[model samples]
Target: MEALKQSNPGIVVVWKHKALVDDVYYSNMEVFERVFWTFGPCVEGFKHCMSVICIDGTHLYGKFKGTLLVATGVDANFQVFPLAFALVEGENISSWSWFLGCIRVHVTQRDGLCVISDRHAGIIAVMNDPNVGFTEPRAYHRFYVRHLASNLKTHVRRNDMRDMFKVAAYQRQERKLVADMSLIGQACTKAIQYIVQVPLPMWSLFHDVGRRYGICTTNFSETFNNVLKGARFLPIMSLVEFTFHRVNKYFTDRRELSQTRSEQGLAYSPKVTSIMEKNIAKARYHKVEAYNRRLHIYQVETKRGDRIGRKGGHRHTVNFQLRTCTCNKPRIFHLPCSHVLAVCVKYSISERPWVDRVLQSEAYANTYAPQFSQDRTILGATD
Candidate 1:
């Protein structure tokens, strides 16, 4: 633990052990219970990433069997950005509570943060506990849509249940979501009932109000777990070392990549730029009518597009001042939607300035700006 702190400044590593009883064990003897750690670079990088966090647990196949808990965030490039990690005996209320507490204290203190995880009883209980401070107004807890779909499929005994749930989960527009839910109800009443039991805002994109940033699952954490597949088999110290090296490389590689992209004069990450390009192409099929010139609000009407198969005649309101569109794409994804793009094109306004900072190249570079002590390779240090 001392070595870790010495190598990485501002690193937070915690070790918890069972208290020894005077009658049972010696004063110096203690049993290890849990350990949590977050890299200094990762802690600093997460501030530039999305506010949403995805957490998951994986089993350890080593001699001292345990579970590995991972917390990851999504970068502007839509890649998994590892934030914190823990090795606990198992997934339980006590361990999960302690893990979450450590994350709040050491990793981030941002309010209105959104946390996504499986429907684990331990996580649900801890987040619901008022003392834990994971509830609304401080943080919002949501279940991964994939896990919810799996549970619904298991309970309903229907093969199509998962597909139906996914359609509803990915819907950005409220009317589209209603149509998808109606279809699910017609397909299986039990499935819709099972899904409705879970809060709409918890899983559905339409009700998420851009809190999820278009992420509907815990795949980010799961992907990081897969990267540490071999490390989980090692002992505690070995596992920690393995994770440290891998995460250092992850940050170094991404930082360099962002630097190269910035050198090419890219305003946004490739993922964000690609999405914007598609929206720009679609914008050609939309006609914009100015509604409030002072407020920069316009009503955008869509025309039939053969390439996108978009049905024409849908009207959407775009407010440039608020950076919102009635289609909800801009608010949900933090980028301009077709309607907003059309307004920008019609008025000869630049769309780059309207994109959220989280998706911009500058923010992406800032996310990976911190250098690990091991390499000391600096790439666009925003600090």
Candidate 2:
């Protein structure tokens, strides 16, 4: 640990020790309780990523059994960007609160941040605690819908009921969410009651004021954990070394990939481009009807056979000036929905301008621009 500090002066490494007395310390082995670390480059690079963070905890299989809590962020291209990690004795309110306090101090110190996590009691308590919590004006907490749905199995085990619960959680508009939840309530009042206990904004995308950037799960952190499966059995310091090299390589590879995509003249990342293409294709089935140039509004009428929303034809209002569609897809996902694309086609407007800046290749490149130092290298850095 001393060597790591000497090598990377900018890295944030925190250690908590069990106290012996006011001025005295416990023995070296007996003192250590928890440790948190964040690479310097990661701390700097996270500024370019979205404000949404996904946090999850995994157990360490090392000789000293401890819990590995990780906080991960999403880049502009929707790729996982690991931010900070901590080694704790267990998953409990005290441990989680300590870890979050470190994150709040060294990492995300800004307002309007959104944190996504599974419905872990420890995490819930830490976020809700008034004295040491992510208060309203500062940060918002969101739950992983997949984890929340798992609780519904106790009340209703049917697949259709589960699907109804998902529909309510995943809806991007409040009216549609109400309609779906009403349907679920009619099917199983117990399931609806269970869901109502959780705040709508925490799990439902429609009501979230913070820009979650379409990230609704802690799967990003879970995926990173899977990548570190083989390293979990190493010694405490060895495990930290393993993560350092793995993350270094991740940034290096992604930086090269972003450069290649830019050279190819790609305006947006591959994921964003694919979504736009799919929406463009769907736009063919809809026809643009009335246009109010003064109001910058257009009415997109769905074909009689179209089946996206309800069965028959439907009319959606599109306001180009506001970059919103009545269907709510564009505003929700920050991409041009089929309805909005139809309006773009009618006006001969380019779709590139409508794409959110965060989805562009420039933002994707910026996310990986920070270089990890190769000179101060860790031994056995490979998986």
Candidate 3:
């Protein structure tokens, strides 16, 4: 946004997860089968920052046992952008769908792209999800190629209508599957009643790529998890919240760094400065048709002595609030030429105050901060 700040103006949030959590919630609660209030907006921030989203899960053996999965994305500069996290019962369609849905709701914008792990069921979950009912002619869902390969692996060894095998497959693939299935079974009929009835999409989001890459074999998420390896784990909520705040902080820092470099380039990097100069001179001031800054208005010069505009002279005018002398420079180059500067200097308009406020960097850094306790190690985690 700093690069094209005027072109696209909007705010974005980013989020991520800490260490893995398994069985964080009870299977009776629904997709997560766990206990906790849903904090989704934080997750959506991550997706908005990174066009690509990565998802994965691990079994938990702590106080509450369940599979903890997380979703993260990459920002414009290809840096990590936090998304959302979920506690589920192993990695499965329901768990994944729930995670995806959380993200869909959390991020505010409706037009950005998405990238997910190469997992078969994730593809299936989005296709088969009932909540994402066929209510519209244009339903948008996307996934990466790696997930299809994962789907193939699990499907390859499966047969039809064998409930036990289904449970066994879940168990075999994920050890905690036994605990999850048992937990769901305890819910009697309400839990399993509508599962199969859910409509799965006919085409996988990345179905075409699976043919070439093989089914069930992409570790983008798994590999990324390593980035958090050995890192101190925090509460699930804290982790998710941290993701969004952190992404914003990173971008704010990056923008500042870019600005520093740009200024340095303006003074020393002729090649870089030339490009910016050309854009300022040619793209902006080639012709004057209307007031570019003013949303509505007509531009005209008063007759001085008074001719409004003379053939051999420049067109001087006080159009809108900007004083554009017969010379055109301020609007075109985002910098005042000698003529306008002369007016400002004569009028004693403090350029220093306006410049600092217009290009302040402190707000960029103060975007958000981790809620640090006087005691850094003492964190209350939301499972």
Candidate 4:
């Protein structure tokens, strides 16, 4: 392999699918069981006091021909908790059910806030089905992937659903889902509603992307995918090493990020502060009951010509602010209105603070920092 690599610099050694890295690497049933079973308690223990759980799944291209992996985590301070991982056929209900069941068992606190994830039928199935949960309110959850759908692609039969995506996202849309999923689509919609209802010990449990005071979706499993990126292509021993190394790096980097954030004095940089203030001001856009009534009256007058309520088509009419657009986003659901984005523009108010910290790098860890005393406490650093 070394000789071949030396000769062909571009060569990527492709191993057969489902190849185990160790005797226990998915091959040893006991090891597989251990890895799989560890998910619930591990996550349960990790998310003990947290309010929201951000969930997502990605394909871990490996020896298992075209197999995928699904996982979830809590995103406090952008910290990642390894909830679970399973080699699965595809990202669907069955896979999510198994994963959620593990989490449900581990999530003994019958009262944590909802889990957030991208809107795939699999996740929606878990969230929407009344039978999926053991008790009341059915463990509320939400889906933020509505932005993934585009207008030409038409994610929602009702205009309300399509309108829920980021405005820019909806305008520059692509049709990924071909067949129209009417019932299943609604199930996903209801699932999101459930997410908002889950009781949170505090508002901090949920993230308000765009700072819009609503549950916005971020790909929670994105980092896990990064951890697995090149590791998936390596051989067994290499894969194991890669996992440990990256996970180690993940923790190391996270610690550094925390310390750096602390030193930066909570005041943000001028540019970021400007953006944040703008977003906050945008969020400040509030009106009383009269404002809503006036808006509703205007909408009735303008959209009177269109048979919006009758539902001649799969699309439903959605209302937002002064706009009575036909989409499920703001009108049907009080979530962000992608249509508003189309008419107005990206409101700066709803953006979250954590995302901006990465680029400034000021509050982010200097990856190769020198280690000093215990806890890697910088030689001159305090706290």
**Number of backbone collisions per candidate, in order?**
0, 0, 40, 25
Itemize residue pairs with steric clashes in candidate 2. Answer: none
Each prediction's TM-score versus the true structure:
0.92, 0.89, 0.38, 0.44
Instruction: Give the alpha carbon lDDT tens digit for every residue of 1-383 in model 4.
Output: 01101112211121113325455355432222111222122333343323445676554455633233534454333344444444445677866676566556433345534566665677777776655562235455654544343321352344544443233222211122111233334546653343234332112112222221234446456666765787555543344334445544655666565455547664433434554454334322321122243343211112222334532212223234433444333422222333233223222333222223322334333322322112211111111
Q: Write the per-residue lDDT of candidate 2 for residues 1-383, one digit (tens) a residue.
A: 21123346446667675656456865654456778888877887788777778999988874779899999988777888989988998999999998898888777787778889988899899998867658776888888887777768756776677677877888887788889988988988878888899988888878874368777766788888877889878876787778888899988988998878888988988888888888887788888876788887888887745545645377899887787787777766778888888878878887776677767888788878888766544332211
Which segments of candidate 1 are over 4 A away from where they belong?
1-8, 20-28, 375-383
Off by over 4 Å in 3: 1-50, 61-64, 133-220, 231-383
- Expressed as tens digits, the lDDT of each residue in 178-204 for candidate 1 is 999999999898888888888898899
Worst 10 residues of 1 by lDDT: 374-383
By TM-score: ranked, best first: 1, 2, 4, 3
lDDT for predicted candidate 1 compared with the true structure: 0.84
**CA lDDT of each prediction against the hidden true structure:** 0.84, 0.79, 0.37, 0.39
The residue-level lDDT of candidate 3 at 222 comes to 63
In model 3, what lDDT does residue 309 have? Answer: 52
What CA RMSD would you report for each candidate?
4.5, 3.8, 20.7, 14.5
- Deviation of model 2 at 297, angstroms: 0.7
